[model samples]
Target: MMKIRDVGHAIWDRPLGRIVLLLVGGLVIAVTVMLYPPLRDVVQWFLPLGLIIWGGSRVYLYGRNDLLSLISGCLLILGGITRAVFQLIPLNELAGTVANLIPVVAIFSEMFAHHYREQE
Candidate 1:
């Protein structure tokens, strides 16, 4: 008795729509993953990239009077290098990644450094 479009609008415009969308996205990814093999080297890039991003975040705290952050950041950087070595990332590509992250690092650093300072 109800039109399909009316039903879609009722269900898809509510807060529950977000959860339904996530489930649908996951199902699509699962089907696609079965069809296409993941690239190992591409997957390996995430290790160093994530480390660099996280370490850069801690390193930024140095600007806000946290020396411990510098220490932790240095440790994380070392860990990233170790991960890159283990993951077989080429030096050239690693350098390129670091270069690419320069602006991203600055933005994240600034954002997080003052995030707590702003009051709601």
Candidate 2:
């Protein structure tokens, strides 16, 4: 019979095993959050805040040297701020959708610009 410690070590040794474990942990947390109304509300409220932090960090780290990255990161930060503001203001769903799309479109445009510039 294998020892529990050995089994745990075996799981940690494989990349797939680690990924599966991380995914399972995330699923468990997601389900737990969904089960509680208050927790769900808290998560929703903070989600945009998380996005803002992520975007700001990206801008600070990568935007200094690359103008396109700066634009894309700024758009991401704007989208997060717009979402947070709309949550409190009771805006139309279309406004929120547009806000969410800004970062995605900016990123894609930046990528294409970089690709074309490199090809020249």
Candidate 3:
């Protein structure tokens, strides 16, 4: 008897492919926000939320063995906490902003990983 193919492992293993797609997605969203003034601030806030949801979706799709999703979730949570803590710090603005976005990027990368894995 043949064993069932484990789709989750197949996709998450291709780290480079996932990273490329994530960079593309981030660029698209960033460019869109830059072009649209009204949506710019809102889009920035929504990115972290979107990343969290994307991570959850990966967990649901890939099951509990999804270490990538778990790590992404942790990074997102830490980023959120750091953002909140640094909100009052007027200095280091760029650092805080990048810190806030790290988890979002991580999750998107993981999601892309999962997506491409399924393709293979």
On lDDT, the candidate that comes out on top is 2
Q: Please write out the lDDT profile of model 1 over residues 54-115, one tens digit for every residue.
A: 77777775635664456556556666656666556455776656644553554454455446
**Alpha-carbon error at 117 in model 1, in Å?**
12
lDDT of 2 by residue, 1-120 (tens): 999999988998999999998999889879989787678777777757766776777678767876766776676677678877877777677987776676567557556645754766
Query: 1 or 3: which has the higher lDDT?
Result: 3
Off by over 4 Å in 3: 1-37, 80-101, 104-120
Q: Is candidate 1 or candidate 2 better by lDDT?
A: 2
Every candidate's CA RMSD: 10.5, 6.3, 9.5
Candidate number with greatest TM-score: 2
Query: All models: lDDT?
Result: 0.63, 0.74, 0.64
> What tens digits encode model 3's per-residue C-alpha lDDT throughout 1-120?
433455544644789757876798889988888898888867755655565565566557654665665666556556555554555466476887787677667757676666756776
In model 2, which range of ten residues has the least summed lDDT? 108-117
Task: Give the distance in Å from residue 106's predicted Cα in candidate 2 to where it truly belongs.
Answer: 5.2
Error of 1 at 48 (Å): 1.7
